[model samples]
Target: MEILNSKEMIYSPTENREEKLSITGRVTFLSMVAGSVLALTNFISNSALAEDVIKIGTPLALTGGLADEGKKQQIAYDMWLRRVNAAGGINVGGKKMKVKLVAYDYQTDGKRAGQLTEKLITSDKVHFLAAPFGSGHTKITAGVAERHGVPIVASTASSLSVYNQGFKNIFGTLAPNTGMTEAMMKFFKKKLPGTQKVAVLGRDDVFPRAMAKSLSKGARNRGFDVVYDELYAVGTLDHASSLSKIKSEKPDWIYLTGYTQDLILLRKQMSDLGVTAPIVTMVTGPAYKEFVDGLGKLADGVTSSSWWHHATDYKSDDVFGSTKAFYTQFVKEQGHDPDYVHASAAAALIVLQKGIEKAGTLNRAKVRDAIASLDIVTFFGPIKFSPNGMNQVRDLPIIQVQKGKVSVLHPADIKNAEMQKM
Candidate 1:
């Protein structure tokens, strides 16, 4: 027989006057009980540890066509995670639960994006999910998250089509392209007088297609002769044909709506073809240093409309401090300024953190309700979700690049510089 240790023995209650239980027998009994108790305690400890980890998954195109935008979002998200971690994680129901961010690169492929999202939700079991670059990528996760009952916030989906889907689990950070069109036209009317014969070129994707439609409608409505409008593929390399067509139309202004590569190539083609019309403007996402560097002097004087401008110094602006802080940290870490996509993603996290803090619980349903009903002010402005979960402040900033630097030129309250024609 094996000898047992002291902890293995225990005395039993007895009314027998003669004797007590045997030590060996007691030892065996105590050993079983101690083993059972240890097992139970370990199980409980593991359960607590699991509860402490809140998994957040993101599928971004870190490489490939949408690489530029995807990289920006990842940078912003890193800053967000760092800031939240630095502040001692999220306070959930009076207890601090550390955030765990799980990111995957979809390589700018739509199918791969969906595959990654499904794996994150089913295999990795992330608690929350973030939106990636394009509308198609966001739509894939929308269906997956809805089926799994996980709420998602789309960090870069700017298409109005996202809201039209009526998926309760998905919400986007950017305003609809329709709103941007109206705002852009209004700004042009105010800033540039006698701007007629407008030519618009857009990528044949959800965002640029919708934006181009709205821009064309607004231009025609405002009596600004819609001279030539064309839609090219998202990743189209040659803009020579489009430029030739627009040149033949003899438009006074050229309006472009597309992502980085298309914009950079088109600008170079425009300069190469000497298609200088004195009224060229693009709708956002290309006013960054990356775009300037990609196109060199070809990027000079190009005006673009954006949602955030770091130069604006508004005392009441909610995002000023946070934006500045993010830019400082981003430059230090990534050696560059956070672009619109990055800034938008950071702002999304800020709003989400506020909602989580207000709800005071880690319950998914409760957090979703809190986010839906949240009306808090954030770094951008007063952040109140509409019935469809869009931010109420849909105003965009019109920025002009002067001497390789971006400056806000519209919305008098936030305008820090005068407009310069490109």
Candidate 2:
């Protein structure tokens, strides 16, 4: 992943641009300041006090392989916080509380994320906790929050095991891998006809392993021949050997599941090895804009499933309205377009606000109960919690990257382009 520079702000105003104040000498300025001390002091004091405050803790992958996702999530969180504060904050038992986001970079390390979550709970004493960017990192931190009985909204964790852990304090914003892979299989069978042979490759992480298992099963159920299947460690930097094995089988399609860098390296090596055939469909490629930018022309013709795509052909305003607003603010703040990170973070914040409102109090237990019972109509659509704490909107659309832009190719409601052979 590419490293983003630290935040910067530029201010420019000439002397003549000053609106009203005109002080000729140092003594005049001092005398004028002393003359109207009461007004200035009262204004400053009241403005400071009028700012209500609520603390939020976030442990995200801000510096390592998942930095791209973390940066996007941070931008979304800040935007939501700004919007809430501008609207006079959230109503908690008839009192307003301004939201304050406190984020820590876990650098994509699970151990570091767990440690930071402990500090956030004990030292910072945040009012609420938001989950991290990566699934692996989120799992580690969820344990910490569960031990402390803190209510947490897990933003980007799509694995089913994340909810199966029986941690009542935790809730996932994204659909499970089983459901997502099912949607992908349905699209593949309808779109790619007479192509039965399939190959599945993924790193031996919780998310990829689960996805590969379910996706391979889905392919078989759809009458496709599961030619080859393999798993590697998350640290695998090269897939030449794996690709060589896959080429020997000459499967009709390749289903890759893993982190962004892992997928990029696999795609780059596949191109270099000259083993191009069948369609390569990944699970999380559309979640990051870098997936398109990194591969450039090589990304063309590659198709992947997306939970939230920017293209809006549906007549309903919910999808297009929310996506456009989110994209505009995300690009303005982070200088990039919206991705899964932005959508996940925005959904988490909306869910949190809804839960607090329903509970009528900010108590941890009350909030947890409220989250379990929430049926929210979010910017993404209706988000209802299942018995196991998963979102009811689990079906995702399959999209393809064509001509440097993403176009949906599934479920007719939003398929903008046809799927091409890779």
Please tell me which predicted candidate would have the highest lDDT against the true structure.
2
Model 2 lDDT tens row, 276-295: 66688776775567788889
lDDT of 1 by residue, 301-416 (tens): 88878766665432322333554565667688887666667777877776666666778876667777888887755554456666676766567777877777777777787787
Q: What is the lDDT of residue 42 in candidate 2?
A: 45
Candidate 2, residue 276: how far the Cα is off, in Å = 2.6
The 0-to-1 C-alpha lDDT of every candidate, in the order given, reads: 0.72, 0.75
Stretches of candidate 2 off by over 4 Å are: 1-52, 312-321
lDDT of 1 at 151: 75
Over all chains combined, what TM-score does candidate 2 have?
0.83
Clashing pairs in 2: none
The reply for model 1, stretches above 4 Å from the true place, is 1-47, 313-321
Weakest 10 consecutive residues of candidate 2 by summed lDDT: 6-15
